[model samples]
Target chain A: MSALLEVRDLTVRLRVGGSDREVITGTTLEIAEGEAMGLVGESGSGKSMTAKAIARLLPAGAGVEGSVHFAGTDVLALSGADLRRHRAKVAVVFQDPRAHINPVRRIEDFMTESLRTLEDVPRAQARTRAADALEEVGIDDPARRLRQFPHELSGGMLQRVMIATALLSRPLLLLADECTTALDVTTQAEVMAILDDLRRDRGLSMLFITHDLELAGAVCDRTSVMYAGQVVETSAADRLHADPLHPYSAALVQARPDVTSTAERLVAIPGRPVSAFEAPSGCRFAPRCPHALDSCRSTEQVLTGLDAGRVRCERAATLRGRLLDPTESPTESEETADA
Target chain B: MPDADGPVLSVSGLRKVFGTQVAVDDMSFDLAPGRSLAIVGESGSGKTTVARMVVGLERPTAGTIVACGRDRSRPARNAGERTRRGREVQIVFQDPYSSLDPRQSGAAAVDEVLRVHHDHDAATRRRIVGELADLVGLDSRQMSALPRALSGGQRQRVAIARALATEPKVLILDESVAALDVSIQAQVLNVLADIRDERGISYVLISHDLAVVRQLTEDVLVMQRGVVVERGRTTDVLDEPQHPYTQRLRASVPGPGWKPTRTLRRPA
Candidate 1:
């Protein structure tokens, strides 16, 4: 099966204080046709950059070096009108709906503009199509919603509008960047349901970026864990949850709050993710990893397995017990347990 | 419902209004010392408004807030006297990045509190900020860096450290961990738990995530449009939610086991 979108050795740089700073470091992945891939990491781990790069929407200060191929076309090679049209192939849904939807514009305009570039329908037809899209996404009173301002609608409704707009273009690929994080859980679940239904029906491939592991597990078929802008591991969501191959991925699993688990206290990763500018020497997560050893500090690893989507972490296999390291506790770590 | 141990903070029939819109109405809950009470609500349900009122940011149109046996304590009004109330209840905001003044460095920001609130001189203030930063897992080197330089987790940790500067009795976290990454969310939640155990500080944790609330808080309060819809043990509310709103909230948590292909019927 051919991939809907394949990204190769993507590296993005930006000028910071007279020196170039690398945002994405040799990041690579692919989204299969009609598949969902979850890109997850802490902030500044280059998740959003990868999405922006795919959309060809990097800001003016950014410099890029990589190849993103979609539908038999080298995305980077597209020129003039071709590039703009190619850019529309993969639509992006941002973290906050307010950020993407114009606060000044009405719902009617947002829906119309989304389709204007992608389709050549009559104005009356477009309005009817917009109302239909809104209804399809489960918006109540679709006609009333069209005239309302962005602020007048709930965050969930605004997001529905964003999704409705994305679907208006009928793109094969969609990029949702923490799009549900800002919403309440009830609304998030509703939005998730809509996305799941839409994907199956429309055969939409998604590159879903979030810092939430639970959400990734629930919504994604496969997940790629990133740390310091590198894809640490990518595997089936359930497999990753059960047996994470990378040290960072393992820690994230233990940290997720599960309703089934009766653990007395929530486990916390001891240290913060490494600074993006000063990437960790060997493994990006080595400094904070409980399984970190002398061998991990000197040897850098890369993606080694295509069969099961495994990582090159030298300590991953042998570091099993220490992955959670039940005994090891940072000094102030226990003070909160009793609370 | 009042208990034998007595509540450090108690609210009853709390109501708030913005013109014709009732942001919060008839909210009631009790916070015991060293205990954490999670307030879970949907957006526009008045969870933050309740917190703001408890912290005295907004005056309550009705109801009473009794703190440490005083029927109602004076709210934080001006910069000069705000520190006095800061010792009673300190609030941790959602966005740590914007919460701090951009002009001041991390250390300088923490030190400012010490200088103004703690009545410490420049030298002492700097030292105190170093201790605070270290307490929240931040290094002294980060003291000179601006808020923009730190990661989301680090910035939020800085916010936590600043909240602890006055040694507040009740720490009110309003979507404190919501903006953080999942891994960082657990880390910060741990920090909050540690603070409560070490200092016997009570917490008024406000969130919309039921799983997170169940993990950290023992007691829970479910709010709907400012009204206390349900109140009980966190496990009780999560495991067997009695209120319709509470049940819906619990069902709403997205996880691998549950298929994200069903939507609950809209509230009638």
Candidate 2:
């Protein structure tokens, strides 16, 4: 089957002062039909930028290079009615629902406005479809909820309403950019489940962007680890977590706290996360990686295909089998030896 | 400062109401010296309100707060008494960006705390500020830099250092590490654990993240809708939760092999 979305050699440059600064540098990704791809990275890593570029939501004065093809159509070249249709087909749900939703507007008005105005659906039909979407997301009393304002609902409920609105358009591609990050853990789990179920039922392709590696691993079929505005590793979510090849990916996995296991100290990744502007000439993670060599500092590494995945590291071959899974518990003797 | 009979911090029947809404209802907990307690709850669960009451930011509707062997059920009568109360327990709030003054350097922020609590010479204040900076893992460069110049983790370090400047018996971390990234959060958590071990200070942690609670605290109190649904040793409560709310909270945390499920079944 053909890919639903293909982004190749995409670079985003913003007008900073007099010179242009690159925010995303040569990022290539593809989402197969009905496939969910997860993008995991820290702040300023271009995860959101990638999503925005695909959706053509970049801020004014930003320059976008390369191509974004959605279902064999060039998304960047679309204009007028074509662009509008493309946008409707690709729905995005951001982190904060309150920010996206108007405070004074009723839920029904917000949900049905896009369908009625853009798609030329009548008011009554729009309302009926909106109610069905809300019911699909497990929200009861859709009529009463439709009359309520954003402030009347809790954060979780507001997020559910947002998801319902996204589904109202029956989007072929869903861009969830940290949509669950602002929610509580239980609510996050519930929302994730709804998204998972909806994707399966509708055969929707998803671009799941988040700062959480574990969450991405759980929900996405494949995961891409981004660092300094570039994808450093790409692998099956389960394989990536079980044994990450890139040193940066290994460090990030080790940095997260595990609720089931008790470790005396978390293995912190050294040095602060760098932005694209401050990224080094060579490997972006060389400064913080423990196993960085002289070549890593001066030589830029491109993504190389491995047995089951791709990694952008100079020493991935040599370091294979030596990297231990961070989630696994070390033996008592090993723990004591380290201590 | 060790009290064999009494806890370092204690609360009894704590309650807070905002006009018609009950923010916190009949909440109670205690923290012994050199121990830490975690209050886990979702937003609007009254965990933050409890912290605010303990820090004197909010006057409790009813209940008593005993900190460092003194009852602070009511607001302090005078500035001197307020300062005395402040010297006993200090709080670090969630957002490091807004909690800190944008113009003040980290060194200056810590120095101001020393000025209020300690009547020391300029040289002594400078020495103490440097020591506090070092304790929180802030380098000299970062200490001299303003809050805006530092990253979220660095700003949080300055905030922690300022809180420790008072030499309080108890520290209240109200979602202190929530705003940080995972890597930076780990670094800050380690700094907090080191402080607890070296200084023997008690801690009251308010957070929604169960993993952080499991890592940093010994005792856990799970709150839902302003009520304490469960309380016990952290491992016991997390491993085998008796309350339905606690079970849902424990299961909600995503880990290896975790799959999202339905929302918690509403209690009858």
Candidate 3:
């Protein structure tokens, strides 16, 4: 099946301190129709930058290269009416609802502003649609909620409103950038369920960007691990969780504290995450990878097709079955038996 | 009756009222020396309020706090008393970005704490600062860098270093690693474990993440709307939660092979 959104060789450069620095270097990704693709990375990995680039939301003094094709149209080449039309089909929900939603405006105004101004819908009809959207997100008494301001509602309720507003545009693709990160676990679960249900009901495609690997694996059909502004690995979610090929991916999976496992120590990556400017000439993750070789640090690696998906590590083929299984570490089972 | 050698910290019927709203209500717990206890709850659940009360940031309307075998329910009346309390218990806040002064370097921040708490000479202060930095894995270069120059994790390390300057008996971590990246969080968690091992300091960890609570804490207290809904060993409470709220919280954590489900109805 053809992809609903395809980003190819995308590079984003920002003018920082009078010099242009590459923030996202040759990152390519694709999301098939009705599929949820997770982009997992640490800070400065360019996951959010890549999503913003695809959405044409980069700030001033930012330069872009490569093409983003959506529904057989080049998103980069669009302008004026075409750009507006493209934006309508692709909506983004940010991490913090309080930051994105205008505090002074009523819920109805925030929800239906785009529809009324862009689509030229009547205010009365827009209000009706707004109420329906709120109800769809599981908020009861939609009419009462529409009359209230942003601060009148709780964080979880406001996030629901934000998701409801995004759905009002009827976008085929949604970009959720840590939409649930600021919420409590129970609220996060509720929001994820709502998003998942919405995607299944509407056949929506999503690009979920977060620092949470386990959350990504739970909600996304496929997962991509990014390091220093590059896609290091991509695979089916279950396979990626079971056996990650790239060393960085494996380390990330091991680094997390599991709820079920009783491992004595979490395996933390040795060094901090590197930015694009600080990235090495060869593999970006080589400096911190435990299994790195002399040759791995000298030559740049390209993404190679594997059994389930693609990986950028040169030794991924040989590293298979040697990497640590995130959930089934022997120490955990032994500790469990002791308990 | 409290055991003579039972716990390093103990609280009985702690309550805090902010105007008409009760931020923390009838909360009680105990922390044995070198033991870690996690208070897990959502926002407005009074977990933070309880932490604040323990650290003396907020005076409780009711209940008593006994730390190091001294009563701390009433506000300290003098600077000496406050200093004594500071040396007994210290808290690390959530936001690392705002916890430290923007103008002060990491080394300077730790030095200030040393200067205030200790009457050591300048040479001794400098050496202690370096040792504290090394304990939290901060390099010499990062020691002189300002907060803005450091990453979230590095800033948190500085915060941890500063908190340890007094060598307090009990360290209150209020969502300490929540602001950090996953990898950085793991590194900090490891550092926390090392500190507990070497110094034998008890911990009062306040967090909303169940996975993190499981990683670092030995016991768990589940709070809901300022009430203690559940309390037990971390593994037991997490594995077989008795309270509905606790069960919901344990089930909400997303993991491999887990599927998102609707929110459970709150038990009345």
Candidate 4:
């Protein structure tokens, strides 16, 4: 089957205060119908920007190149009523519900506003549909909840309300950008379970964005790791930890503290993460990668297919088995060094 | 300094009530010198309340907190006493952004702490500030940069350095690494471990992440609604939890091959 959402060689540049910075460069990925794709990255990795690009939510004066296609429609080329229709087809749930939602509005007003204004549904019909959507997300006493203000609900409840409102449009692609990052673990589990059930039951597609690799691994079918505004690796989510292709991916797998076991010291990646503007000339991760060769510093690497997966590292084949080994040092890989 | 052989920090029957509601009740723990203890719980579980009570931010209605062989159960009687108490215990908060002043550079923040707590000369204060920054793996560029110019991890390092400037015997990490990314979290955790090994300082860690708790602390306490449900060695308690709440919490964490199951209701 053809992919539902396709982004090809997409590059985004932000112009703020007379300065330009490339936030995303050459990002490419596809989401099949009903497939949940995980976009995993640290801060400044541009995972959120890619979602915004697809949703047409980029800040004013931001320059966009390449193409974002959804169901054979050019998202970047959409305008006027067509853009509004396209937006209705895609919904975004942010990290914080309180910030996105209006504090003074009652739950019913907020939930039904989209349906009432955009689709011109009757107020009574919109309220009924909103109640049903709330019920579907596991909220009890939906009628009572609809009358309550935003502050009356807890964080988890507010998040559920946001999800319910997002579903009122019946969007095909859901952009969940760190939706659970601010929640408690148990609450996060509940929200995640609700989303998982909703997606599976409705056959909806999702672009799940999170910094937690383990979370993405558990929830998504395929995962794409981003670094410094580029896609570094793409593979089946379950295989990411066991068999990571890029050195950066391997380092990320090793950097986390394991709950089941204890290591003498966590294998922390040296140097802090950089934004795309500050990324080096060649490979973005070479500054911190332990297995980085001299060639990696000067030669630009491109994403290539390997073992039914894709990676952006040229030395992926040579460094295959040793990537996860904690004791593998930078100098230890000198056998492959040209100098 | 107090007796080196005894616990660096001790609490007994800690209780706090806001009007009619009891936020924390009958909570007690001790931090042995050169050791770390974690208080793990979900939101409103009173873990943060326990930290606040220990740090003198909240006055306990009942129970006593003894730090460095002195009763700190009540707020300090004078400014001098408060400064002295600060030297005994310090805390690092969750958000690095708000905890730091936007206008002050990292080195200035550390220097300000040193000036308030100690009688060091200008040269000595500068030297100590540089030493503290280096101890947290912050370079000179980060040291001179303001909080906004630095990353979240860099800001947190500056916060850690400021906390260490007081040379406190016990440090309370109140969800210190929760706001950071995974890579940066690992870096900060390593810095904390190195500090513990080098200075032999005790730690009272308040957190909800089990993986972080397991990595940093030796002992763990599982709390629910201000009550201690389970407490034991970190590995043993996490590996084989006896309390239903603790079991549910462990099951909630997502890991390799882990799946989130819907509970019957939201736990009270």
- Best lDDT goes to which candidate? 4
TM-score of only chain B in every candidate structure: 0.89, 0.96, 0.95, 0.97
Candidate 3: tens digits of C-alpha lDDT, residues A1-339: 679999998989999999998898889889999999999999999999998988889988899998999999999988998898888899999999999988999999999999999999999999999999888888888999999999999999999999999999999999999999988889999999999988989999999998998899999999998899999999998788888888888888888898876668889998899878779998889889866776789999898899879999888886676577545553454344333
- The collision pairs in model 2 are none
Q: How much is A330 displaced in model 1, in angstroms?
A: 14
lDDT of 4 at A83: 95
Candidate topping DockQ: 4
Count residue pairs with overlapping backbones in model 1. Answer: 4
User: What TM-score does candidate 3 get on C-alpha atoms?
Assistant: 0.95
lDDT of 2 at A66: 90
Worst 10 residues of 3 chain A by lDDT: A330-339
lDDT string for model 1 (A84-166, tens) is 77766788899798987788988998889846655667778888889888888888788999999999998888998999887
For each candidate in turn, the TM-score is 0.90, 0.96, 0.95, 0.97
- Fnat of candidate 1, please? 0.63
Whose TM-score is greatest here?
A: 4
- Which DockQ-derived CAPRI band holds candidate 3? medium
lDDT of 1 by residue, B1-268 (tens): 2343788898888888999999988877778888989998988889999899888889888888877655553454566556566567789999987898777777777776666567777777777777777667788777677888877888888888888887777889998988877778888877777777778988888988777787778898888876788989888778899999888888777666876645633212
Cα DockQ of the candidate 2 complex: 0.58
The clash count of every prediction, one per candidate, is: 4, 0, 0, 0
lDDT of 4: 0.91
lDDT of 3: 0.90
TM-score of predicted model 2? 0.96
Which one wins by lDDT: 3 or 4? 4
lDDT of 4 by residue, B137-197 (tens): 9988899999999899999999999999999999999999999988999999999999999
Q: Stretches of candidate 3 above 4 Å error?
A: A325-339, B1-4, B264-268
